[model samples]
Target chain A: MTSIAIPRPAYAERPWILDWLMTVDHKKLGILYLYTTMFFFAVGGILALLVRTQLAVADNTFVNNDAYNQIFTMHASAMLFLFIIPVWAGFGNYIVPLQIGAADMAFPRINALSFWLIPPAGLLMFSGFLFGGAADAGWTAYSPLARGSGVGLDLWIISVIILGVSSTIGAANFMVTMFRMRAPGMTMFRMPIFCWTMLVTAVLQLLATPVLASALAMLYIDRNFGGSFFDPNGGGNAILWQNIFWFYSHPAVYIMILPGMGIISEVLPVFARKPLFGYKAFVFATMGIGGLGFSVWAHHMFTTGAVLKPWFGFMTFMIGVPTGVKMFNWLGTLWRGSITFEAPMLFALGFLSMFLIGGINGTFSAAVPVDFAIHDTYFVVAHIHYVLFGGAVFAVFAGLYYWFPKIWGRRLDERLARIHFALQFIGFNLAFFPMHLLGLDGMPRRIATYSESSGWETLNLISTIGAFLIGVAMIPFIINVVMAFLRPKDQPNDPWEANTLEWWTTSPPPVHNFDSLPEVHSERPLWDLRHGKTAH
Target chain B: MASHAVATQHKQGLSNGMLGFILFLASEVMFFGGLFAAYFIARADAREWPPEYLLTPEQVASGVKLEVEFWLPFIATILLVLSSVTIQFAVFSIQRGNRSGLIRWTFVSIVLGLVFLVMQVYDYSQLHFGVGDTIYGTTFYTMTGFHGLHVAGGVIFMGIILARSLAGQFTAANHEAVEACSFYWHFVDVVWIALFTTLYIIP
Candidate 1:
């Protein structure tokens, strides 16, 4: 790559710790977000292993039931709130401004404020263990049960509300940045697909997160203030919690994965050596998914006997349409192109294959009758992990590999990446796949153990082995990162011959991102730079 | 490579700061939307405005329905709506480079906002029930209480605008902060009207 000099902020020369703490740079904040969320991911993963250990054999005394409940509850809480949901914001914070050719996020100080809220929130949520016990009522924290849970539940509610506020404001920042901060000649249609997905994701966050906040507040009131928002005795409907919680949560399901799908869209075309096919259709499909997300929350309540069975079931099925459009769009992007099997592509493919199973399995619960048989069972657990772990987590790896050169200015070891990918893919399936059969055979979820004669022992042991293998898989990834740091930061601006605007600048871009952005005449500005701008 | 500094600024309809504030308002709308939805759901599910099932036996034996006073809250509602107008005038004054007018109108809005909060506190003290009393108290207080908080927030927002105006920070061409403050004040005002209808005027 040709050497070029660019101006940077004065704070870049400051002591590293003080710089990170005091600086409002979006890229630095993005890295902070990534590190923080990844730490929580490890924390959540350890909790998963513990849960698996306890459930490995029937009636095994790994942990008492109460400890098991808190463990699993913290696992879901950490994964959903700390890991999957905010990781996209991490990626978005770094990449969106670069992709749009802007200097920083719309509100840089507000961006810092958004990230600063996460650590204290995570610490407070986990601090519950020190007080007495962590929140044992599960992540959902349904009405009277949560009301009766320990002080940990109160801490959980407050921490989640703080996190929600952080995300809400962060989302508003994203929309404004995307809408108003694009470079000259870049229209809405000229945006990269990831920005499009973030746009939709931000819309969902801005609208849905506040509803969750309101529900949490009501829950807090009910638990502490004798408010009857969810108390049946106080003329409050218990279903009210379900209605409001799912209202945010079902949309939140998309908030967790749409960005993953966005990452997949980004990785596919680059590896396939083709422009993303159906770019406009993919954009519309993303918006369609966000729109349909609101209607499908009640599907979760199908077993409660309070919701309209057919309506929610039908809406749940309708979600399949937009999702199917996205799936086909991805397949089209990869069709008849020079496809390569790099680590990012491998993980993207893993997401495609696994998320397909995840989507199909989720639809089974939409049948209302089938949901009755499988609700609160291992089948539901299997479905969630497939989507979250298989779908979103795979894309997270794909994104990390694909953007590592741009973010860190060095390439991770390709050989180690492949090994890491293979183990994670195999171990992920092994861990989650048996739960489907176990669910069908009547192994209920959230239980510490089953009797030896319950016939769940073999599958449980297999899942335990698979879960441990996943833990083992992280070794290669950690080694890859550490090894990459020891090498020279000699990567070119566009190492993969990628097409986005971020690739137009130097690797580990200057503080202002781009000294001079390439004129964007099309969505693929780099492609335009290479091939010369085509006539409209 | 010799660097060429090309402009990255696009011709957006609204400035970044204004757009961001508007988006912030959109989320605030959803927040209040959720609270109001809960209020409506509770109201719809009830056979009576203050559902009979939630009342204490002693309270029920007294044979009086739960009530909110129209007079005090109506006055409070007028004050908040007037504050919105005053904030808008402040925005206009700043846009016209009238710093004194900006300060005057902003101070008036802040005073009006504080008065509205004082009226709410006075009304709360006179209430027949507390937040813990019943579902009626919960929904009523949660909705209006949140709106009251927003009013307080708007007052602070206007105070910042007032301070900036006093420092001669905003001019005719660049008063984005003033405009954003007006937008929030208007949003709080609209929410107050909705709360007035839901809590005070609704029979």
Candidate 2:
């Protein structure tokens, strides 16, 4: 390869620690984002274990009520803000430029700033623990209750706003990089499916996240400056906060999952030995989901009765149409093909089945009557875990395993990966599946204790065991990664025989990202390059 | 290799910097959109403009009229609108390779923006209603106060633009910052028009 001909810059000789701390290189920054977000993931997972242990049996005194609230709230906060959202940015920052055959992100320094904001914000959010207790008002931070929480809640508000800024700028950077920086022949249509999803996700972040910032600001003012934005006694409406928060958050649900869908799309066709079915259809369906995401924010508020229930209900159901399209797109990509069950593919299939259930169960809440039954119950919690944990988390690992060789120039042990996948798949279902029964039995969420006669102890205990199993699942993954790193940079350019431009370059490609380029003829540019250009 | 990237970036017609700035403004729109939606929701829920029963008797006794007085804010609005025009002139000036013209118009725009901010501060001082008075006071101040902050931000943005202009940093061929600053200034102005209509004129 001609990569050796490229000269190293003066700054490349900096101390490795200073190199990491002050680097503006997208690849290094992407690694920083991944490491930081994974650290938070571990922290969030520990908190989840605490939550499960507390709820394992009726009237459990593992943790008292106050600590339990903070535990669960911080669990969701850390997982969603610190892990799921920015994890995508991590993947995008590393992969998008490479896939598009660009040298680096369009605004490389701004890209660094986007990543740097996250760690401090995360520290600030968790710093509440050192003060008194962390924010216990739930990750949603519903008004009235949120208004009265301690300084911890204020810290949460600021942390979220900081996170929102990080993502907002990051979103614009992604949009610009994807939109303006694709290779010569790569039209928007020819761009990789993952980049397309990141594009839609960026649009969502650019538009929806700032609304969340505004909501956080209002909540802050209400708490500190005696503003009455959410205080009903002051002639302000409590539900206004929900309206604004859900407006951002409902789309945020898509922000959390769409890139996962993108990952599944990229992985399926590669392992299946066929191009993705209905690639254009998948792209439009993605755009459809993003557009429809805004209208359905009010669906989260239907139990409040302040919104027009029928309109929101219909819009909520309508969102399922686009989501359903992408599901079929995935299934169609897999049907009647020589599919492999490698680690990435294993997680991809897990995403398909679990995210399918996640989608179907979500449709249940679109029915206003059903939502009335399940709102704020374990069932709602079940739906979130199924989608976020099952869908997004699975895709996250899929992308990680798929790109592991490329990012680090070594392959993860597939045997350990399969073990990791199996334990997680089983543990995930065991942990969350019982919530369906518990919610149907009218066991509410966010409760610190339940009576011995509540009949929830068995299911809760089972779920706790499953949550631990999920924690156990991480051991194989960690071992696999450490073992790989101890070896050497021995991977070839196309380790997975992948179908995009990223695979056309060397694993852990040089500082300029590419030493040479391939002509892009279709979505599967590498595939076409291999197959004598039959693509059209 | 780097030069090759610059070639493709311009294929979109909008430079990456300008396109990104526009998207940034789009987010700013949504931010204010949230505040406006809150204002309207608060207005719809209240039977009285100020929801007088919720007001403190002390507030009433201290001469809080529960009203948004007009003329001062109206004049401030005009200054902001004119500043928007002057910034556009700055952009156009640079586009024609007129260095002195760019500096002169940008300097004028900065003055207009600062005066508008001062007028807003003075207007804020004349108001008897505090942010804690009621939802009326809260929404009004939050929405307009945030807009005031953005205006101050725009002035700072123009300050940098002016300094760059004097340094001969921008030419007719490459003055994306001038264009970006104009877009941001216009967005601030447009948000103000909305705030003025809703908070000052609507009732």
Candidate 3:
């Protein structure tokens, strides 16, 4: 076959600062996304500390009632919106094009627009606190109460709408890039698993995020224009808000985690020194999870007395089947394999164990009677943290460690990574585990204070210590990153004996992603090449 | 070096931009889907369409029926649908290298869209109930109002297309913008039809 015909733009290199500020380049945009989201993660983490501090010993007055509302609400908003959701986009922006062997996203300007939208939206959302108050209705923003909150809620609404637009367009970009920009001989199935998960995630974002925009629009009208969409006395249904919010949000749960799943899928295969067991099954499972994610939004609303409990319960339980399929997929990959516990592999292993607990405890909510007991309690909180912090955050670190050398052309200190992982792992479980007992002890969520007579003090204190320890864990990670950056960029391409097309290029690939293309003959094209199995 | 760095083998079908626009339209469909679901849910929950009895005693004294005005919106709907056809024609013309025909049809479509928006605004004034009156008025105005804004947006889009056409930027082979604009106009028209059926025609 003739060599590919890439259209390289006529170029004069701008100064370094100006280049980044005006860049339509995918790599720079991806780095920008990473830095911005990690900043929010820290911000959100601080808010979580506030929450935990306020709850530490019963009736502790760390913050007043209203402030507590804003604190927890902003914590979740920053984490889910500003951090987790966009972090995957960060990783995807960097990794997807590389994995698929594309030069850049299909729409590079739109990709830049997607990244640039975030910082402003994040500022707008947090800016609410400076003006009277922040949105205290929680991230879900169940209406009526949400309708009447301070001007901050309005800011929250518009900020979220802006975010929805960003993701919606970004999703279309990801879908198109993956669909249209693979290197020769890289078929759909031969595409990296991370790319497949991102494809499903993009589909979810394309379809689901706009529904969120409409919901936010209605919310804005109700809040500002005196519309009655959620006003019960004005003949509106309150449940309508949940229906619309979760329609996006539940899929968004997958949106928040699917790429993390993608990351872990990539990591596990590389470290295990075998192909991902049941690659086709894993892809189907991802699709299954995305599909079932939509149907099971009502599971969140079971206690509202507005949903069909049995049907939602059944669907929620059924979602676990695909998730269960994934568990076996990972285990099968590890079974009888020469698995090495690299930093990335350690985090991947961490995801498997912690996410299993998250999955199991989440299924407990699928049982209607059990949910009735745990709804609006810390058990629910524990479940989410396990899934998000344990599951998504762990996978994030896995990808970060896995791709750090390639992205920065420098490797992180291994001892520090293990220290970071061990501290985080211990601190994470210590923080969230006791919440299950406290929740069963009938401690409600979002409360500013609890009475000491409630007997929740000891467990609460332990959880707070754990929370701070998790804060302590970040020190090593930050140090590792800074330390790595201080070193020279001397790492080779394919540092980990990685198997994707990305490793086929230079570390921190050039303006055009590749110098020359390699013919892909399997999912692990690099492996095939290294083993001399693929024909050039 | 420039010659050696060829574009990678991409799956052949719709161009990336075109496929992206279509996916964007799918998201638009779901956006409208949310508002429609709100309408249907609000409709289902209410004992009456307007929930007139739920009104305050002051609103009752103010003589709000909390109902939609039909005739003008119906006319506007028809106008919007016709605009869809004209925009389609504009796409067809541009595809065939008929630059004059493209400009003419796109201008006609834009004019029709503006007229439809004006008619819808006039219809909004003629309605007895304000958006604040009740859920019925809320859903009615929000859905149609959003749809109306989309129509205005589509008009602006086509106006740009028209401007580009007159500038001689389009040809048989390179008129993706015109095609994209037409897809949007038709989408806005389809949404209006749904709104008209749900809000204006059903009763």
| Best-fitting candidate, scored by TM-score | 2
Per-model TM values vs. the true structure: 0.97, 0.98, 0.98
- Per residue, candidate 3 scores C-alpha lDDT tens digits across A1-536 of 23345565644357778788888888989999999999999999999999999988877877999999999999999999999999999999999988888888889999999999999999999999999999999999997779889999999998999988989999999999998888778889899999999999999999999999999999998988999999998888888999999999999999988899899989988999988899899999999999988899999998899999999999999999999999999999999889999899999999999999999999999999999999999999999999999999999999999999999999899999999999999999999999999899888888889898899999999999999999999999999999999999999988898889888888888878787778888888988878899653
lDDT over C-alpha atoms for residue B18 of model 2: 88
* Model 2 residue A71 CA deviation in Å: 0.5
- What are the per-residue Cα lDDT tens digits for candidate 2 across A8-93? 77888999899998888889898999999999999999999999999988888999999999999999999999999999999999
For the second chain, the TM-scores of the candidates in order are 0.92, 0.94, 0.94
Evaluate residue A204 in candidate 2 and report its C-alpha lDDT on the 0 to 100 scale. 97
lDDT of model 1, residue A281 = 90
Predicted complex 1: CAPRI docking category: medium
Which tens-of-lDDT digit does each residue in B1-203 have in candidate 1?
12435444345478777777888888888888888888888888888876756687886676534677789988888888888888888888878898899999999999999999999999988877777666887888888888888888888888888888888788898888888888888998998898888777778
lDDT of 1 by residue, A176-265 (tens): 888877888778999999999999999999999999999998999888887878886777778899899999999999999999999999
The full ranking of all candidates by lDDT, starting with the best, is 2, 3, 1
lDDT of 1 at B15: 76
Badly placed stretches (over 4 Å) of model 1 are: A1-8, B1-8, B58-65
**Where in model 3 is the C-alpha error above 4 Å?**
A1-12, B1-12
Candidate DockQ scores, in order: 0.61, 0.69, 0.74
Which 10 successive residues of model 2 chain B have the least lDDT summed? Answer: B3-12
> How close is candidate 2 at the interface, in terms of C-alpha RMSD after superposing the true interface residues?
1.7
**By DockQ, who's the top model here?**
3
